[model samples]
Target: MLQTQSNKSSFFVKRPILFVIVVEVLLLIIVTVGGAIATIKELDYIAAIWVSFTPIALILVIYLTWKRKWGSLGFQSLSTITKQNWLYHLPLILVLITISLKGFEDLSVSKVIQFVSFTLLVGFVEETVYRGLILKAMLNVGVKAAVITSSLLFAVTHALNMISGQDLANTVVQIVYSLLIGVVLALLMVRGSNIYPLILFHFLHNLIQFLGPEATGVTYFDVIALVILVIYSIVLIKSLNKKTIKGSIAA
Candidate 1:
């Protein structure tokens, strides 16, 4: 009887996290379906903005609920900026510069407008759903599980773009690359507990991809860079774990 009571207590303790996860997933589904219908009706801009802002709205909703239930807002516990954080963002800047230079030749006013509108809308919406709510739930469950699962979820969501004439091969590549980006973002999320930095990087990444022309194939340099970063990040995460464990034990 005592064991069963303990199990129930544990479940109840985790219910808030689970509730947030369910709400976020449901909202994403509704937004996606509604956006699809709007796109079909040629209301692409409107749909895009709606989908993008939904996540941000949900984040605010969650914050309010959490603040009421707990004493403080959830965002208060997020990671603060550090020297290492700035250094970590350097690679992302390099990637952005390269992408911009490559796309400069074909840039036009109409494409720029479309790209900015869609990219901002999608980035805010998707990151809030996937990284904010989904990630929060996963991290509440287990750190390693959260990192892997969120990354996969983020990657698979990219597959939905295929409905709009994106080639299968290109879609596959984008998904793979997105998974890597997700892994990096997940690392940042786990480190900082804040969503702002991840959101900024994600927005820039999408903006470049949307505005840039002919991002069809992964270059040899990109492949090499991906391999190096994946290996290095894995090692770094492991080292971080060891340090955290040591610190906890000492305390």
Candidate 2:
């Protein structure tokens, strides 16, 4: 019986994409069900969101243990940050700064702490699942495929927000920009070869959205940032391909 279980585990290890998809589906179910329960029971929604990630974290640990592929999940040292990398990331940094300038005046200490904790958990789980596991799995096909597929999956997953009572039109816009951000993030991960920076950036980005001034509508700055993000993503993708070629030649 142990041997049979081992064989089944090995099968999943050999087919990582299938394993990742299964895990993603399970996570989706957890999020949906947990949100529903929270709504019905009048539970603290923030706490519920945090709790929903517990199973995902557990699954990540199990997969890492089973495959012994922690390094592949961006647990290793980051690649060198070149001038190009800084340039590619500049727009995002600017956006973050602008958002931070919006300030945290009205928030209490406890609320700030809670929001930080929630954003950190979100950053860790989402990046691990999308950029780490899903991207790693899709890399078996090719880098381009991995980037596009993982980004699409990441964007699509945000649809869950609508179920949690988000405005439909706003959610649709979010899904679109999220797809672009997802692509940029995937490319950044490939170029940097580390997930920690992405996690930090993701957390800050989310926190900004939570605390920033109320949006009457999409602003000109938002459109500019989106354009910059797309341009940067393309450049990063090319950089990744060049690095791949160099590695191939070295090998």
Candidate 3:
């Protein structure tokens, strides 16, 4: 187990981009297969299968952290949101506003618990992989490269939606929105922020996003989110400099 862990961990440290590609491809496959399986399986059975994924992800994180001897993945604690970096949270606020506008479906206790658990799982896993692992890996190239590459890869992750059921046009827009919003999340790591709050952000946003089964997400929020993120990204890009690459490598 130790040797296997070392070998796997070295693969990520030695070839970060390749590791990222493999991880993304695996994610795509898992989601695709899992989605397909859900249709053919009972709800409780499918839920059990999906919930099992969280522990597997956790084990991977623990193994890698141990093998690499990483002191942190920016997830140990939450940092206070100060005036300096407070603006970076606007996208999350926008998500709240958008969800409010679109509103939510009636919820039972079981459904609310399900949404919380599901979104929390997503938030923890995705943030650790993208912002924590990928961002730290890419920093060796350059700060700009790290930010753009991590964010772009993360954004492209949403493209898998098209394969499942979404239309092409909507998928394209999702990719764009995800790309821009991804940059903000990546920048939080660069700014020496903790991953816990970022995970919480994901939790809240995705809870509304994946609310009830009948939820239609194509509200006016999409257009407004796109515009705001585009302009916000431009300003952030301008702000990147030698000072921006502050976080230590995940290794």
**Could you say which candidate leads in TM-score?**
2
Model 1 TM? 0.71
> Where is the poorest 10-residue window by lDDT in model 3?
1-10
For model 2, the superposed segments whose C-alpha errors exceed 4 Å read 1-13, 79-88, 101-105, 245-251
Which digits, one per residue and each the tens of the lDDT, describe model 2 over residues 1-251? 01244533564436867866886788789887877777788889687886688667777778778876566577665454556655666667865775566455578878778888889889989999898878766665567877888899999998767876878877887787889889988887666556777888899998887766676566666676667677867777666667653332121
Off by over 4 Å in 1: 1-13, 16-24, 45-79, 105-114, 214-232, 242-251
Q: Model 1 clash pairs? A: 79-192
Report clashes for each candidate as comma-separated counts: 1, 0, 0
* TM-score, every prediction: 0.71, 0.83, 0.80
For model 2 the TM-score comes to 0.83
| Residue pairs in collision within model 2 | none
Comparing candidate 2 with candidate 3, which one achieves the higher TM-score?
2
Better of 1 and 3 by TM-score: 3
Regions of model 3 farther than 4 Å from truth: 1-11, 32-52, 68-71, 80-83, 212-217, 246-251
lDDT of 1 by residue, 56-76 (tens): 566655764753421111133
What is the C-alpha local distance difference test score of each model?
0.60, 0.73, 0.67
